[model samples]
Target: MAIWHWIEQTLRSYPELAIFLALAVGYWIGGKKFGSFSLGSVTGTLLAGVIIGQIGIDISPHIKSVFFIMFLFAVGFGVGPQFVRGVANDGLPQAVFAVIVSCLCLFSVYLAAVLSGYGPGLAAGLLAGTQTISASIGLATDAINRLDMSADQIQAQLDAIPVAYAVTYLFGTVGTGWIIAYLGPKILRINLQEECARYEKEMSEGEPDGGMQSAWYQYIVRSFKLTKPDFIAGKTVAQAEAGMTGGERLFLENLRRNGKIIEFDANTVLQVGDVVAVSGRHETLVDWSNRAEEVADQELLQIPIESIDVVVTSKNANGKTLLELSKSPCARGVYVTRIRRGSMGVDIPVQAQTKLHRGDIVSVSGSRKHVESVIEEFGFADRPTSVTDMVFVGSGIVIGGLIGAIVVPVGGIPITLSTSGGALIAGLVFGWLRSFKPKLGSVPSATLWFMNSVGLNVFIAVVGITAGPTFIQGVKEVGIELFFWGLFATSLPMLLAPLIGKYIFRFDPAINLGCCGGARTSTASVAMVAEAAKSNVPMLGYTVPYAISNTFLTLWGMVIVLLLG
Candidate 1:
C-alpha cells in the first residue's frame, strides 16, 4: 500500500511525464501492429498524457524542451545530405517552383486572415512557417516580443495559433496534392507524370558523373604529397620524368583545340599550356605538370537537366524497348537511360530493344516542354472521366471523414469518436463489406518520407510553443471547460478542412485525408494511404499539400488568435 501510494504520488507530481510516456508506449505498439499507427501516436500520446496527469503524474517543461530540440536536430541531419544533393542537381529549379507555390498558398491564407480582420504581424507569423503549429507559435511569440507586447497579450496570441494552423496544415497535405494532380493539367497546363518522364530522359543523357570530382585527381595530389607542377611545362615526357620514380605509367595526350586524346611518345616535347594525362599517385605525378595539364582540360558535356522519375504503366507505348522507344519519332531527342523497377529499387541501364513490360518505370531526359509532350503523347492512361470515377472520389471522402470522426473524440469529453478513427473504421468497413470499393492510387516511399518528416516537425514545434506555460496555465485554471474547449478547437478545423478540400478543390479522397495526416504531421494517415494506393504519386501529392498547408496554417493560427484575443 505504501509503495502504491508512493507511485501514485510520483504520478501526481509528474502528470505530463506520465502522459508523454503513455504516448510513446502507444505509438510503439500501435506503429508495430498497424505499420505506423500515426493517429494513435498523436491521440494516444495526448490521451495517455491526460490520463497520467489526471492520476496526479506530472512532467517538467524542461524535458519537453529537450525532446523537441533533439527531434528537430534529428530531422535536420536526416535531410541534410538529400538537401545538398538536391541543390547540386537541377533541384534549384524545382525548389524554386515549390517555394513559389508555397508562398502563393501563404499569400492566400494571409489574405484570408487580413480580410477576417487579423493584425498584419499576427497574420504574418501564422503564415510564415510550414504546417507545424509550433512553428507558427514560435513566429507569433517572436513577433509579440518584437512588438514589445505585454506578456499577457503575447500568451493569449500564442494560445490560439495552434488550433488554426493545425486545420490548414491537415487540409493542405492530402487534399492539395489531389487538387494539383487533378487540375494541374488544366490549371498549370501540365501533366506531372509526363513531366517526370521528360526529366528522366534528361538525367539519362546528362549522367553528371555522380556529382563528384574525379577521385583519381584528389588521390594523386593530396595523398602522395607530390611536388607542385612548375618545371615540366615545356619538357618532353622523358625529360619531365627525368628525376621521378614510377614515371613509366605517365603519358601525354594532345588535342588540337577540338577535344581528341592523341597519345604522345616518350620523346614528344610539350608546349606551354599543352594538355597532358598523367597517371600515378600525387608525389610522383607532381613533377609531370605539363602532362597532367593536357589531360585536365578534357571537355565535359554539359547536362542541362538532372534527375527525374517515371512510372511505367501497361499502356506505355505497348511495352516497347527503351532503345526502340528512343528511336521512335515520339521519342526524338529524348533518351530512356535508366529504369527503376517497382519497390525492388535498383537502377539499370537501358539495353537496346529490351522489351518493355507492364509497370516498368523508366527515366528519360529532355527539355521540360518536350518531356511533358512525350508523356502526354505516350506515357499514362488519360484520367478516367466516367461517372463511376466521380462517385468513387465522393464516396471515398465521405467514408474517410466518417472514420476520422469515429476515432478521436471532440472536446476531449471522450465522445467515443475521432476524425481519424472514423476514417479508418470506414475504410475497414467498406473494404470488408466490398460494397463501396475505393480505388486508391499509388503512394511512393519518397513522398511518404517527405510529407511525414516535414509536416510533423513543423506541427510539433508550432503546437508545443503555442501551448506554452501561459496557455497550459489557462487550461489548468479553467478546469473541465477548458478541456472541452481545447478538444473543440482541435477537431473543428480537422473536420471542416477536408470538406472544403473536397467540394471546393475537388481533390481525390485518399489525397484529401492524406493531407490531414500531413498537416497533423501524422505518419499513420500517410501509411494508411500508402497501403491503399497503387502508385506513389498520391504521396508526392500529399507532400505538396503539406508544404502549402504549413504556410497557410501558420498564418491562419495567428489571425484567429489575434482576432479572438
Candidate 2:
C-alpha cells in the first residue's frame, strides 16, 4: 500500500516522467516478445507522450526543446564524417538517383493530400517534410498567422497534427517496406542476393581480413606435420646431420624462451629443448619421429591455437592508434595478432601504432569467451550487410550530394540542405538507377537504429510539449479530417513511390522500403525490413535512401514555410 501510494504521488508530481517510463517499459516488452512491435526508442517515447496526453497529462515545452536539440546534435556528429566521405568518393551517380526518388515520393504525397481537399501549403509542408506532422503544423501555423488566421484556429489545427502524423509514420514504415519486399523482386527482375553481393563487394574492398589467413596457417601446421621426439636431443648439429640423406631445408620458427635448436650446419651443436621445421615427405618425417621416439619420449609439445576475425564499429575506437586502445580498459588481454587489409590475403604483423578505421576488419586469436567479450565490449559485431555494400552506397551518397547541391533547387533556393542528406540521396538514386552497378559499402545496423531512436525521440518530445494544454481542444476540432488526410498522404506515397522503385527504376524492395523510411526519417521500419529479410545488407541498401529522405523532410519543412509564408 505504501509503494502504491508513493507511485501514485510520484506520477501526479512528475506526469511527464511517468509517461516516459511507461513508454520505455512498453517498448522493451513489446520489442522483446513481439517482433512487429519494435517501433524503436524514439517512436516508442513519442507514442508514450501521446498516450499521456490522451489521459490528460501535460509536460513542459522547455524540457522537450532541450532534449530535441541534444538529440539532433548527436545525430549530426555521428553521421557527419561518413557523409563527407560518401560525397567525396562518388558524387554524381548518388546525386541523380537521390533527387529523382525524393522528388517523386514528395510529389506523390503532396498531390494526394491536395487532391483530398487539404490546404495546399499544409499539404506541401507535410509532404515535403515526409509527413512530419508537427513540423507541418508548425509551418502551417506560421503561414496561417501571416494570412491572418485567428490564434484559436491556429492552435486548434496544430493540436491534432501529431496524432495524424504518428499514425502515418506507423503505417508508412511497415506498409512501405512490406510492399516493396514482396513486389520489388518481381518488378525489378533482380535477385536480392545478387544485388546485395554487388554492394558487399564494394564495401569489402578496403577491409582487413580479420585473421582468416593465420587460422588457415595454423590449420596447415596441425594437419600435415611430421613430428619428431627430441631427435636432436643431446646431439650436435654435425652428429644429427651425419645420418640424414635428403638435402632438405630446415628452419626454426616460433621458438620459445629458454628453447634452443641445433642449427643445420657442420660445426653447430644441438640442445635438449628445440623447435624446428623440416621440409621432407610426411612418411619420412613420421618414420624419423618413430625411430627417435624409442631413444627418447614420444611427445611433441606444440600447443594448438586458432584465429578469428573481428571488425570495429564504435567511433570511440575508430581513429585511435591500436597502442592507445590496447592500453585502455577495453583492450585487456586481447592482443591483435594479425591484420589483413583489402584484397591481399596476406597477414601483416600487428603494429601497436596502427590507427583503427571504422570499416577495418581484424583477425584476433584468444580464448573464445575472451575474444567474444572483447568484441562485444568494443562494439565489434558482424556487419556483413554494411561490409558487403558500402562501395556503391557510398558512391551514391557522394554523387547524389554533389548533384543535388548543384541542380536540385529547394523552393528555387540554391543552398544545400545537409551534406550527409545529399550523400544519402545520392546512394538511393544510384541504387535505383544503376541496379546493376552493385552497392559499395555498409553502415552498422545498430548505429542506424541508435540514430533513428535519438532523432525520433527528440522530434516527438518537441512536438508533444509544444502542443501542451490546447492539445485536447485542437484534436476535438480538426483531428477527424486531418487523420484521414494524413492517412491518404502517407498511403499514396507508400503505394506509388515503391511502384516507381519497382517498374520505373527497377530497384529491389529493400530500396523502396529504405526510401519511405528515409523520407519519413523512421528507423524502425528500415530496421524491420532488414530484420525480416534476415539480411543486414538490405538495411544498408535502404540507409542512403532513408538518409536522403530524412534530409529532404527536415530541410524542406523549413524551406516551404520560409518561401510560402
Candidate 3:
C-alpha cells in the first residue's frame, strides 16, 4: 500500500510521466496480434490514459493543442502530393469516388447520432471511432471548444468523446478487415486469388518479377565464357545480342579476351573462350544461362553497381510512358525496378505503358554511372537523410493558423476552418510544393513518422486522461446502444461500397475492394484484402483513395460537430 501510494503521488506530482506511460503501454498492446486484429496504438493509448486518469493527474490543455497541430500538419503534408495528383490526373475518377464515399460515411454516422438523440460531441466521437480516424478526435475536440458554451458544459461533452470512441473502435478496426477480405469478394462473386493471379499475369507481361515487395533482387549479373563457338565465335556483340530473346533488356557489361580486359563496345567481335559479364532481368538471364559456359570470374563480377530512388521532376520525363523513358540516352544500361506513387508510397504496377507523373519516385538499378545519369535526367536523387527543415515547418503552421482564423458568418453563426484545419490545408500546399522543388521543405520520412505517430498519440493520451474522471459516467449515459449505432454507421457505407464500385464505377474486383478499404482510411483492411488475394495488386488502387478519404474524413470531424450542434 505504501509503494502504491508513493507511485500514485509521483505520477500526480509529475503528470507528464502518465502520458509517456500511456504511450509505452499502449504501443506494446497495439503491437500484439489477436487473430489478424489488434487494438491500434491510438485506441490503446486512449484506453490506457482513461484508466490512469482515474488517478486524477492534472495536465495542461496546451500540450494536446501543440501536438494536435503538428499531427494535423504532418497528415496534410504526407497526403498532399497524391491528393492533388489524383484530382488532376487519370485518378480523378477514384478521387471523386472517394469523396462521395466519405460523404456517405459522414451522413451515415450523422443519421445514427441524430436517431439515437446523441449530442454534437458524441456524434463526432462516433464518427471518428466508427471511421477509425484518430485525427478526427483532435478536430472534434477543437470544434466542441469553439462552441458558445460554458466550461462545465464543454468538459462534459469532451468527456463523452473518448468513452464513445473506446466502445466502438474495436469493431470498427476488425469489422472493416472482415468486410474487405471476406465479405467484399463474396459480394463481387469472384475468386480473389484467381482474379489477382490473372491481373498479375496481365501486368507482368514483358516486365520482370518486380511484381511484389521482397528482399530478393530481381535483376542479376553473371559471367559467361564464349564457349559456343559455332553459334557466336565470329559474330559481333551487337549482332549476337540482337539475335537473342529480350535482347533490349540485356547488357553486356564487360569482356576479357585472353589475358586483356576489354571495354564494352557493340561492334566488338566475339572470340571463342572470351569471358564476358552480362546483366539483365533474372528470368531472362536464367533462360539463357545454358547457352554459354558459366564461370566465377571475380574480376569481371566486381563492377560498381547501384540502386537508387530518383524523383520524377524534369518536364521532359513527366507525362512520358516507361517505354519512352527507357529509350532515352540517360536510361541506357539502367533498369527500373519499381515505381512508388502517392503519399503512402504504395507500389503501383510497373509496366511499359505506365506513365511517369511529375511527383512519382522511380527506383532504378544499374552501373553507378548509368544510375547517376538517370537521376540527373529525371529529378533529384532521394538519398537517405536524417535532417528536417524546421523553418519550413514553423512557417507552414503559422501561415495555416492565419488562414484558418478567418470566419464567415452563416445565418449569424460564424464558420471557420479552425487552426487545425488551416494547418492541414497549409500542409497540403507545402507538401505539393516540396514535390516540385525537392530541395526545400525537407521533412525526412523518419521525422514525419515521428511527428505524425507520436504527435497524434500524445494528444490522444492527453484527451483520454482529461476525460478519465467522467468516462464511466459518460459510458453509463450512452449505454450499449451507442455500440449498435457505431455498427450501423460503419456497415452502411462499407456494404454499399462494392455495389457502387461495381455497378457505377466498374472497377476490377481487387481494385474495388482496395478502394473501399482506402475510402474508409483503413490500412489494415487493405493489407488484409491483399493477403487474401495473394497479390499486391489491390494496393495499386489504394493510395489515391486513401489520400482523398484522409482529408475529407478529418474535415467531417468539425462538420459533424456543427451539424449536431
Off by over 4 Å in 2: 1-19, 22-40, 54-59, 91-95, 116-154, 189-253, 257-273, 276-462, 465-484, 491-540, 563-565
Better of 1 and 2 by TM-score: 2
- The most accurate candidate by TM-score is 3
lDDT per residue, candidate 2, 1-565, as tens digits?
9996777567657866665665565466336535555554444555555554443455554554333333333343333333332344332233334556556556655565556655434454345334542333333333344443566755544554454454455545555556556544454555655665555445344333443222112111111122343456556544553445364322222222243322255454444445433322344455455543322211322423335666555657655666566545334324566553211112223444345544345776643434665576554544345333445434544554455445345565444433433443443343322211122234444544443354446546545544545555645655566656656655565556555655666554444555444444455555554555455555433434443444455445435434433
Ranking by TM-score: 3, 2, 1
lDDT of 2 at 60: 58
Error of 2 at 36 (Å): 3.3
> How do the residues 1-565 of candidate 1 rate in per-residue lDDT, one tens digit apiece?
9997887776556454444456565455334444222332432333333333444332443443333322222232222222332234423332333343344444454445555554433343334322324434433443343334677765555454433333333333343333333432344334445543443444345222421112111222111111234555556766854544553333222223224445466687655544444434355555444333323333422213322445443344544655445534344434555554322232333444344433345566654433554666554422323233324323644555554344333464223222222332343333222211113332234432333343333334324433533334544444343233333333444445455545655554534444444444334344444444433333433333343333334334334333333
Query: Under the 3 Å rule for N, CA and C atoms, how many clashes does model 1 have?
Result: 78
> Given candidate 2, what's the lDDT at residue 450?
45
lDDT for 147 in candidate 3 is 88
Per-prediction TM-score to the true structure, in the order listed: 0.38, 0.54, 0.86
* Local distance difference test values of all predictions, in order: 0.39, 0.46, 0.84
Global CA lDDT of candidate 2, please?
0.46
Least well predicted 10-residue stretch by lDDT in candidate 3: 208-217
- The alpha-carbon RMSD values of the candidates against the true structure, listed in the order shown, are 20.6, 12.1, 4.7
